[model samples]
Target chain A: MKFTKGRLLEKAKEISTPRARRMSMTINKTDFRKSMKKLVDSEGFKHLSTITGIDVGPKIELIYHLTRENLVLSLKVKTSKKNPVLPSIVNLIPGAVLYEREVHDLLGVTFKGNLDLSPLLLPDGWPSDVYPMRKEWAPQDIRKAMEKP
Target chain B: MATRIPFGPQHPALKEPINFMCEVSDEKVLSVRPRLGYIHRGVEKLAENRTYNQNLYLIERICGICAFAHVTCFSQAVEEILNIEIPSRAKYIRTILAEMERIQNHFLWLGDVGHEMGFNTLFMYSWRDRELVLQLIENISGKRVNYAMNTIGGVRRDITSMIMPSLKEGLNHLEERAKYYTEMCTKDPTVLRRTVGVGMLSPSDALELCAVGPTIRASGIPRDVRADDPYAAYEEIPFKVITYDGRDVASRLMVRLDEVLESISIIRYALDNLPNGDVRVRVPRRVPKGEAVSLVEAPRGEDLHYVRADGTEKPVRVKVRAPTLANIPTLCKMLIGENIADIPVVIAGIDPCIACAERLVFVDTATRKRWMWNKQELRKYATKWYRKK
Candidate 1:
């Protein structure tokens, strides 16, 4: 079934919140999971390509990318660094395993029940407790630390 | 008991540095654990600091080979966010450059695959012919490696009629060479012996694993981002997504070869029907606060980029999901129980870019060790340690 951009927006509006229909949403992690699962089952959104995490001053926003009937649905979840955990979607989409692991590894967010969260792209001896993508670290600091024996 | 052997981080045969640890039992791979993040430069983090215009150059540097695709996708995402429409002629130009990149990339992969199988003659033949495509790219973009042609609103360069004749001749030469190489590789008994039915990925496996590009097509699953989800001038231009039901290294090779032919055809069509208009549209300086995802068929498979902007000079977040990253897990799955000697051929089957694969960083709890390896090094180590007894 082919869907034009307008039809997709309309379908999204019928099922998702107004914010989600506009390709954005702000929901708790638990509600985010439910909304995503609902979209998956009803809309046949089988593909979860990757998860994008952003630190928005006071909160971390998690974007779950989903595609259904030719339209992309990005489900957003906001959480604080104090308790950064989200439900694992590995069970829903097997291909998302590596992507989920990556979100866990880089953003320091835990995906509960994520299998094989082992080191993927990072090296074996990479220092812990330091997230390179965090805005605070300087490039010189990373280079100096990397140059260390 | 199975012994675990570490294959990379530094090794010959791998063009880039990548590390893999494999468990071998009697010369057969029992399981493989890939250690990545050796070369994570924090491109996403870097995107955070750079202005929207400046990030264009940084995104192009994501991978030298797929630089065009990365910039094109990034540009498209930013354009979509700004709700700007590119000129029709610019769209056609972007399509032409993309197909050109595809031709050169597939040729590069062909040569690499031949070298992997110890067929240096084929490698030399493929690379020698690939120069023609590269020359054409240099003629159009003025730079070979990182063609900074794609801009936020449209393309930085235009395809004028002055170069139309040369482009057509180049396409003709490439088509002839593609045919010759495809026949030589597919008909040769040694090539067939090494590739046919080796590292089989069933259709179900390909779909379930969400394999893209030639990897999925080799398994008889026809899913091309260009055709399935049309972007750029692909909607106007017509091209077939080639596939093979064999689901082996040979099948993947054939799929790419046929795709070379299809890309050539598409380029010819786009150039012949090239539209005339302004080269670019002016995009707003600040994008609205929203998120957009753009997918393009990077010479490899599906190249995805997600951009979130909060009406600022820098993006709030940027995530790039290259095709090689998605195919790695599936490649690891195919490596199991295969002869150690065939590892390189299977690994090259995906035509992976290790630089793109190492986009994420991992923290090691035990020794506090952090290092990154590019794609080439990873394969060399896997073959050297695992292929050798």
Candidate 2:
């Protein structure tokens, strides 16, 4: 019943590109935490639906889907593949802890401030460096890594 | 001394495999750490290799109870990327099957919860009623557990008028039973004793933790994705977003019970207004380079599916965020400050769909003594503990 006015869209323009749609915005990796804070505190984007971390050739794209009533704003941030590290939003939104760990487990992206980056959905003795979701890991590669030394 | 209890990877309460290491002093829980991924099949990575339609079947397998929800959300996301508008009748049929799945799933959870609380009478009756509901679903889709009715473009099957009579009859029966169960759950002293004030998640905590479905709704959120985002025929179908302010195990029970009735009404509305047209549209295998996120209000909560197609037969990436995973943090939060005897009821509060539930091995920190209890033993201990109270 409660749909926010364009306040989030307005605030999103501060750090994102002009190509921002009504439901999504592409923000620079540097302004990721700031934009997430502004949206959560100012525009009522408190409910983080889920975080989708995808490997995009040279970069890893992390989309934080924030929902308030009917409005779902996809806040997309791109971090380099070589050094995929981003500020942890668990401080701002504590619910993101497991999701951050899931991303860390599969994509090898690091959430700087999230102390508990333990493997969420992987075997206990699974290799630390091998993230199966990355494009380089084939079906056979995942199986090979899981094989006991 | 702070003793530790490792709850599961083979939990006896919720019948699921996931571990929770709880630090407790005597019977009082201090902190809980959840270790998941026991059943992790790597479906997300698997989805990237398979074609759009192949991914449809794979995603649904993510959850046995809410299989159709995953398929619906996955198919809808792929349809969005293809920019294909499915027929109106397809939308109506999708809603019907979805609500049917919700009805069946809630009944399963109801039976499971009753079993968890040492109340086999409620469990037996609820499971009996659940079978009839499953028959209605099987009659339409020919398969009960993982109904492959949904395809990329639309649903693969249609609900003809010939099947309407049986569907209506089944729903009428479910409605009566649902109302009775609702009344019994609200008034029953034993149910009240086990559920009331157990697993308390405040409105702010729920919203902050991003709790979904009946879990958050029970906390008085009223944030159902069906009403909010308006997927399938939900925008046209009228229904109430059930909410309860109790914010405990009882409130969660009441929310689901009321929602079962709401879902029945939704099914009735969709069936009455079932439109006439083709059920599905033929589409190309290769989707255009695009991305979309689909959210469905499954029986447990909001089920999410995100798809990014790279102009190929296989998708670039597919992400599934099941409702149970979303509520784990809240589950961990609720486990704290509760008696060890009340562990099963609290874990079963969120209606977790897994292999085993209610297994706890207690380890004394100072003396280094360890002991274990199975699901039945734990349930019996809870009964005796409550009897003493």
Candidate 3:
């Protein structure tokens, strides 16, 4: 099947916002896996390029960037920062394992079914409860903690 | 018994720091689990603190080999957020520098591969020719490694007529060397023995694993960010997306070598059709609230950046997805079921950049006093020492 941004929007039209040469849309937290599965199964998205997680106040947003030919489709999902657990897409795209691990380490998000999330980009002995990427820790607080001899 | 072998945070074969816990049974491998984050500097977190313009300097240092790729990607995203159109001349100049970086980077990777395979002659020759590309870069941008050429709306530098003659001469020499290396990689028996059929990755596996750049192209997939989604002057310049179906180390080497030639031609085209205009326009310090995605074909593969602004001078979030990180899983796929002796070659075959892949620590072993330094301490020291020098 010829995969294009238009074809991807057809399946998740309610969530997708069309941009120039690309489509950006926010899917419900529950529909992320199924929406991604349908797109991949239909060959509408040939590649799971990268998954980026950003912490925005009380919620954490996850952006899944998928590409095919010249078209890019970004799927966004927001999970509450209090319990930022989302479904693992590794079963659908095994390449997402590392990215998931990275997001988990930096932002305190959990991807269920991702068995090996024991720190992908953070060193050992790093404080387990501290998510450095989250905004709750002010620059001064992190500096003070790191500076304490 | 499946004896586990630890391959590095430091090893003779690895150019950067990475550890792979390989479960092996009598020299055959079972599974390799990679431990990363030894070099992660919290650049994403750092970007949230720096302004849009300052982030270029911060992001470009993520990978020295693909420094231009980082800046270009960051600049493109910021420009998109501001909704500003860069001049045609700036786009052409950006393409020229990006391709120059590819040539130098491919040369460096080829040399590293040769060293991995115990081919010292290949190592020496590739680095020697790579200096030529660096010289051309130095002439254009006044620096070699971190060419801070990309600015917000466009590039910071321009190629004048004064340097065109020597630039063409250097490119011609590079083209000849690339052609020779391509021939050597394909026909040399010693190279074939180590590379041919070793670390084989089929097209389907490459796709499923999300391999980018020449790694995926080597597996018979012609997906190139430059061709697939034309950025900078790529839409205007003509160049073939080189691919090889060898599905092994040899194909990967051949793909990069051929790409060097393609980059040379693209550079030539950009220079010949050089547009006349201001190289850059002043952009506002504060970017309006919006999000932008910028994708560029870095030397290794597709370099992706996502920047979100909140109508402030600083970005709300900046995410950099370097190419090497995407290729790591594919590296694991290639390593399994392979002979332990070919580990170095196979690993180098992916052009793994651990610096771009993980979080790192610092140890001063010379004093026999080993205490790990935090990312901020090391970054401050490195920046102060380097900039002062």
Candidate 4:
């Protein structure tokens, strides 16, 4: 039922309908930019609510939630946790700039085309590769690491 | 030739730790580069370790002013995963507290704006009047700032007869004052001169830049989470999504003032027609494996929360997107092509909660005549600049 309403956005790899107001679809990392650009231009999903990146073992899942009217469509993409790299969506939706930086700072996903992926949510002098949001980093370890030179 | 200025970490106006590196030529601001993350608490990283119920208190502390909004968003998301609807009485009570919170937050913002523009009289007046709502909230919630009023399934406390009368009386006073302040802001030349036609953000820019709450509403967009996505009893309580075409600092002030009035009516309606039922419902300790997105119209703007459960007491992931973070990019957009003197007013115009949003302080030096001014000197310069005009 939800797919018919959003048939245009459907080269969707897999559909998972949750509740009724929000729907989540998993798309290949390769198809993410193409789908989001179309979602912005023709489908009126200009407002990028937020981008959530979660570290789920071997992969970091990045969900970009876009809203139009009352419906929220989240496009989920997973990249390898060892070296997570995804194309930036700043050119399509300008508001995704900060959200992308935040994802990079915490989960260590590098957006290839982002102008400044420099630590957004992390403090100024934070270490380059110490991404705290990954599952393995404990609170004490992060605190100790932050205190170092 | 242009020189760069570091605006904060110890604010001149906002009194918070946040910085904006502005390139200035004479008095005109050429461009703005913002540095945030001074107080990043790693709340999301911590949430992954704590249980679902324990996260309620932890998440509530995300913002002092919008404490209830944060909890409401968090609880609603968790409840969705649990798939148990809260009772009608709880929904109505939650709506009242949320609107009451909006009233107090807007009043606080008005005081901050007044302080920023160097009109301390407006500051004194708005803050003094703000106590009525705060006292009313204190009476119901026991603790003022962190109410802890909302739980996963429902609200914690009920609005009793003892608190209800005072709540009604306080709304009457706040309504009158909201209107009076509106008239004062629109009429007073000092206020008008500092605010009117300053920090202009067009409707299109506001939308594309993802501005929210009064900031976007001021720019003539009626996108409100309360009206659009009806959380609590907001759909039942009749209210208008106030918007102004002014698209400037003046419009932002008017939008917040009008929202205070609107919130008052929403509270009054919720109270009068409140449904009778149990305030809370019991749910199992473990939530089924699911992910749900919840939204609440916080005092500042749309507050978004997402919860992922692995059929355990502890959540797998919890994400919080505060309104100020969304507004910061838009704030940067508005600051360009404006004078240095107008910086404080424009920054204050967004109603930034910098602790939750970001913070950083740095200065860049080169072959130039550097006018190193912190918030005090800049605010004084702004006041004097307007006074001499």
Candidate 5:
């Protein structure tokens, strides 16, 4: 079965406040699980493309890129920098295991149920608690730490 | 008791650094765990610091083999935010370069699989043909590897009539070789023993794992970025999405081989019906505040880039999701319950580019020792062993 963006977004709104735009849809973090559930059930967004973790000011924004056929849907979820914790959707979408671990490694957001939050892309001996993707970890800070005896 | 074999962050079978810890009993793999981040350069974080134009070069470096795919995906995302319509000629040229890259990448993967399977004759023959495509690419873009041909609005160079004659000749030669290779892959018994029904992935498992590119397609699902979501000149250009239900290494080889034939036709069609117009348009440094997602069908699978601009010279964020990242979990799924000896062929079937997917490693700075084991208990065991020694 084929679906237009409007039809997909309409089904998506049942679980969350998904305001559909030109080519994509944006959703709130609060309704993330519900919206994702709805999309998977009705919108055919079974394929988890990739997750993008960005350090936006006070929060780390995680964008879940999901696709079904030609239609692409990106669900934006944000967690505060001070206490970054989000529900792990690995049970719902198993393919997200590596991506979630990668976000945790770089941005320090914990995906609660993800059994292995060990570093996905950071080097060994990279200091604990230093999230390189975070805005606070400046270039000079990394250089200083690397050169330290 | 199951014996654990830690196969390569560096191994003879693996071309790049990625660790796979498998528990085997009676030579069959009980389970497999993949450890990534052996070469994480933090390319995503670095993109935030550089301007849109300058980052083009950096993004291309993400994968040496799939360099053009990265540039095209990045440029398309940036162009979407700016809402600039690239010239028709530019679209055709972009499509041409993309197909050329696909040919080189597939042939390279085929050759690598041959090397892994101890068929050096296939490897030599495939790479010999690959060199022809690389030469044709060099003829057009003037650079073999990182053809910095794609820019924001359009492309850096135009495809001229002077290059068409030789380019067509090159494609014709490649077609003949592709036919020969296709016949060999089907008829060859040694290839059959290594690939046929070795690593099985059901369609349901593939979709659940969210595998992309040819890996998923080999499982009997026709999910292709180009066919599903038309990018560049894909809508105007015609091509078939190749799929095989063999659900094993053999299916993957056949799918890739078939795609090479399709790519030849697509490139030939684009060149023969080449549109005439300017190749590039001047894009402003400061892009408007907006977010855009661009998906390109790279040789491996889907190449995706997400761009966010806050009315600045440098982008607020640029997120890249290479295909190998999406397919890694599927590879893990295939590895489980398979013979340990099938590891190399199964992994090679995915045509994984670990350099593009991985980023970091675990190291104990105090002891100056790398974390060989993923679990804390295993790390503890290693520490105790070291202390005893």
Candidate 6:
């Protein structure tokens, strides 16, 4: 009942592997959404604290952080930059709206079905085209771009 | 008639720079949209470039009041990644510092909450008593704001026998003062009239919104990071998790006051059982390639830090999630259908760190104006423009 970090990761690996190749179970996008809903409703991982997005080379990896008891289940979902989109978990975890909005604004990832997709952190008129965290966008260059009328 | 009022990035009562676009009809708040990110320093991006040790100081600067909690969470994440066992003595000291911070921070909030409610006597008394805890922290860390006492593995300062007596005396004084403030606030009819039954967040709403700290506790949830996770010396200490079922501003105040008493008890217990050993253990400069999360009970609520390192001096990724961020959505929800006059009091009930919660820009659809202006434009248009000129 006391969930250590090791035990939680082991559970995730057990659920992910066995049925799939490439060492981990890469659930299809539809299956991933269904599994996430099931986890929240049945498993009691109700609190969605944050959704972290990390750009890994060709794909952007999204980690959905959920907590139940002392265990944090990070559901990892990866999508390519060319078509970076994921089903919005806002309806299941209403608290995730701000965090989801943050990921959308900062990383330029599209969260499908997000009602309030307006900028969460960046000001309006901040070049809609520029994402600050990307490698190609330098801080000085962003500032210069913002200044251009 | 319906109208929208703009509460600012520079309001008098708002301690930090944040703007709120509030829609009101018949002097009642219909809804409020918070416009933030005015003070965002790009801390996450900065953390990516700085060494793990350097980020310690940077994280501390995230919020001046919650500096210790931030660095402690950051250090714990690094320690977890490196598989370092902090000395038992170091853990005890860290707990003591954290409790000390909780004590002073609650006192500060007590003062601010009283001020927001127009109770100047309570404000003056609470702040006057708060200096004792601040002085205790200064004695241990040599500074008031950023302690610089926490390292990756453990604490830099040790609690010596000579300072033990002084700490006890300070706690005794604080306990007496806190009792007096609690009595005055709890008994005062005006305070009750203003705070009680105002900005009520039901338990279901709180759970759905994932409100943390005293906010959730006010709604009758018994989740405390210190109690649940048992980080540092918290497992060794004895303390009760405080909760109130009223789910109102009064309930929130009661929870904080009760926790202040508990914090005193924790500090006394930590000092009595203080162990003798090295304050800090040496940790490797480059942590192993791993990701870890550490949660701490900050004065506000649950403070979480997620860290990822790639066996380098710098952390590959660092995400700082303050309790204020978790509580904001709930606070915004409560603002709906409430009288406009009570807006400040309701907002203060959550005890937000404007610096932390205001991490997003608000866009005005009606005006078609972008709220996320660059620093240069801010300098050109905001009050700072006149000052600079």
Chain A TM-score values for every predicted structure, listed in order = 0.78, 0.86, 0.84, 0.91, 0.80, 0.79
**Whole-model Cα lDDT per candidate?**
0.77, 0.86, 0.84, 0.86, 0.82, 0.79
Instruction: Please state the Cα-based DockQ of model 1 relative to the true two-chain complex.
Output: 0.48
Cα error of candidate 1 at position A112, Å? 1.1
lDDT per residue as tens, model 4, B199-264:
999989888988889999999999999988898998788899999999999999999999999988
- Residue B5 lDDT (model 1): 48
Off by over 4 Å in 4: A1-6, B11-15, B354-371
Model 3 residue B230 CA deviation in Å: 0.6
Candidate No. with top DockQ: 4
Residues B203-295, model 3: lDDT tens digits: 999988889999999999998999888899999898999999999999999999999999999999999999999999999999998888889
Model 4's TM-score against the true structure: 0.96
Q: In candidate 3, what fraction of native interface contacts survive?
A: 0.67
lDDT of 6 by residue, A91-141 (tens): 988899889888887788998878888887898888887877655665778
Residues B303-368 of candidate 6: C-alpha lDDT, one tens digit per residue: 889888898898878988889888888988988887655666788899885421222243444664
Candidate 3 colliding pairs: B37-B359, B38-B359, B38-B360, B39-B359, B39-B360, B40-B358, B40-B359, B40-B360
DockQ of 2: 0.64
Q: Candidate 2 chain A vs. true chain A: TM-score?
A: 0.86
Give interface RMSD, per candidate: 2.6, 1.8, 1.1, 0.9, 2.0, 4.8
- Can you rank all candidates by DockQ, best first? 4, 3, 2, 5, 1, 6
Off by over 4 Å in 6: A2-28, B11-13, B354-389
**Sort order, TM-score high to low:** 4, 2, 3, 5, 6, 1
DockQ of each: 0.48, 0.64, 0.71, 0.78, 0.60, 0.38
Residue runs of model 1 more than 4 Å from their true location after superposition = A1-27, A32-42, A136-149, B11-13, B354-389
**Winner on lDDT (4 vs 6):** 4
